[model samples]
Target: MITAKTMATGLAFAVLTGGTYAGASTPKVKPNIVFILVDDLGHGDVGFNGSTYYETPHIDQLANDGLVIKNAYMYPTCSPSRTALATGKQSFRTGVYTVPVLEKGNDQVSIFSRWTVGEEHIMYSQPLADAGYKSIHLGKWHLVGPYPKKEMEASWPLKKKLGQPKPSDFSWVPYHKEHCKAYYPEGRGYLKNIGGTYRGDPALEVGGYKSKTGGYFAPFSNPFMDQKNPKDKWLTDHLTTEAINFMDEHKEGPFFINLHYYTVHRPVVARSEELTEKYMNKLGDPKTGQGMETGKKKLTTAQYATMIESLDDNVGRIAEFLDQKGLRENTLIIFTSDNGQNIGSNLQLRGKKGYIYEAGIRVPAFVNWPGKVDARRTETPVMVTDYFPTFMELAGIDYRGQLDGQSFAPLFKGEDKALQARPIFWHLASEYRNGTCSIIRKNDMKLIQFLATGELELYDLKKDPKEENNLALKNPETAQLLLKELTGWRKANNVPLPPNSSLPY
Candidate 1:
């Protein structure tokens, strides 16, 4: 175990730096971490997930080299899932259940604590930072704003820049980019931060849409497109490059990089002309920038294929970077999405993006730690909330506060029972576009309740993984038993109130 004195004495650093790349001494195993989190990539969307329609070869490579959790989960959508991930706790516990667009300082509507990222709570990066790891976050910071247009026009941050539209799109409120400081990778305790969007960039020039960050616009537009002095790199390349540089500088010390991306999220075109042409006009016009007609046809073979292919390529780049740096053997590379895939993302999943269905909550999770972890696929049910405790245990760090998750570190070392079979709970008081209000899945037996009408449905996922069969009617007693378990689980986790935030000073 890495004790406080060991960490303070720079043992982790000395161990990390002493060995050469090709020539090894003690394997130079300091365990650099790279966490690739895609925004809105779904369960049924990739080539690995029985997707004959789309290709995600790069993402699939991690599966060949690491454990792929088939039943991995997150919250129903972006902000909520992200919140759960950062805190290792639920949204309600942080009072951050929905997408927050307003800033506490700016003329924004969403309060950080009461609406989005709870101001009263700290995040996972804090623990990593305490251990002297550099935490870096990139792309798709969506919870910050729908921003008030009037305040954005007069806001100090936005006003400092020249020739930009006022954040007037969010009614009269300004985009709440300030509250983002609390949860941003650097704010949470990263050594540095790369990319995150507080408000939509106005220069993409989609005729109908004034703001160009969220929704269906450009699939993978460069974040530095409007920069006066732009860097010559693709979005994925830039993220990977920064990661490599960080590793180079801290080759001996531990580092945590949150390599987030806005891939296959919306605007399903690739950056290359050849790839973009395949998706262009197949789904929507890139120049005109609009989505395909509803019910007319969602994802074209080319568009869907391109989206998956590009995302794969982007993920694969990180793998390639690791190989080049000779950091492949010791580093733990975890690839996961914030939530499930979105529309046109896949067909096997019933719902997309913002719903509480299996498609929205279930995600593809791959952890690649060369030579350390067995390169095999596992059906262990895991959740995003479990990562905080898992990493802490893995890095041998200490913490004074409470966390809602258990460490899956033993599983990485080829140990059993680390994927401990437990009832993972998800409580969402917010609106789901479709699907039921609440759900409980354990040991392949799932129960969903439509809270509006007090209706209940049960499915044996082992028999009907797609949730086609409803066994609640046939087994009322069994359904009641599971429902009781769900209630009990929620209470045990401190589901509603924010424990850390609610404490009296």
Candidate 2:
């Protein structure tokens, strides 16, 4: 456990020589951490990850210059991923197995949804805050309870009037303002929060005609953000600006910023006319090319590509800021996504987001620490939960608590062979497609057990990355061993199962 005295000593050392007290012999400098989390970004979405459609030069260059984690895992959905990341525990502990509500169209809830992440949990930032790290949370902050209970109750009449209430209906008013103030990033641990709200994306419009809450371009309906875009800037650009400014303000020593960009998620909007036209002409069918990816067929391939490019461009902006400020060598940038790819992009992977398949859980993760981490690719299975311990170790703090993740800081230092072998577990107990399921991946073998139906699917991820062949029945021994381990872990964690009663659709 990192006592307050230890943290104070580390802070004193950092103040004097820009290094931390690793011990009497070994002293290490804590790097400024910039954690960039994208929403609903797919495994095959970035240029470094073999996305022929989208262009991500900055992200690709980061991967080329740093470490690319090929087998990094996250929860199948946003809330679960954020929950595990915040608490350093799996979904079983947080009860944030999936997005609170899984709605069909926009109004009808097909899945049994409940409030997931709450304020009482010990978020990673709380520890960092105690360690004297000035933290900022930019962009989406869905870890708060899905929404105020009052807002959910207010939507009933609108739901009855129109199959589903519009995005505008729930975005603002008296209640939402109160809710945002009560459960936003500042209420959590961030000293400053811009564009951080309860919902995934406030860009939702009410009409079934559009898929997003609101368009990606401002004027955004986000209550937490100011409508100060006179030039009608893109949301990603605005967020990048805020993050760069925050870094500049806190360029003294060690700091942590969670820049969760709300781009490339959904309600896929076109970028500037120039970039949109470039992608459209580059990838769109000449004769079949219509408008952006929102009409008739809603072929948003070109729009999605543009969104990625914009995200990459903003990343370049951050990189430039770090370099120009001479902070690149001391800043550690960790780039990843909340969940997996959205539909229409990840065809090669088994399933899209919101499933137990690799496509839904496997995400692109890259860590860059100049003068420390080297450029390489690792197939070691690392979960988002591991980031908590890894960052704590980097800050020269010993975090002792009930944590489900092990620090991969040793792997970052090129001691790749030193990492201890362990099984990474995932529990998605919500009313999605196949009901509730639990997964455990040990080494190259993975076993998935379905709750609704007593079924098991085993796959050798090394041999079949696509999970095409299930060797559960064929290799009973391997399957049984995996099941025993998974069940034992579940029993230990007290992971919840779906209720016996039929779910309300």
For all predictions, the C-alpha RMSD in Å is 9.5, 7.2
Q: Report the error of model 2 at residue 274, Å.
A: 3.3
Residue pairs with backbone overlap in model 2: 42-341, 166-206, 203-213, 203-214, 204-212, 204-213, 204-214, 205-213
Q: How well does model 1 score by local distance difference test?
A: 0.59
Model 1 quality (TM-score): 0.75
* lDDT for each residue of candidate 1 in 200-251, tens digit (9 for 90 to 100): 2222334323344332233333232233232533455555666666778877
Model 1's C-alpha root-mean-square deviation from the true structure amounts to 9.5
Best by lDDT: 2
Worst 10 residues of 1 by lDDT: 19-28
- Which parts of model 2 have CA positions greater than 4 angstroms off? 1-28, 103-113, 149-165, 170-182, 204-213, 230-232, 283-298, 415-420, 501-505
Off by over 4 Å in 1: 1-29, 100-114, 143-180, 199-229, 276-301, 413-415, 418-420, 492-505
Q: What lDDT is reached at residue 225 by model 2?
A: 76
**Candidate 2: tens digits of C-alpha lDDT, residues 10-84:** 355345433222311212666799999999898888878877567889999998899899888898888789889
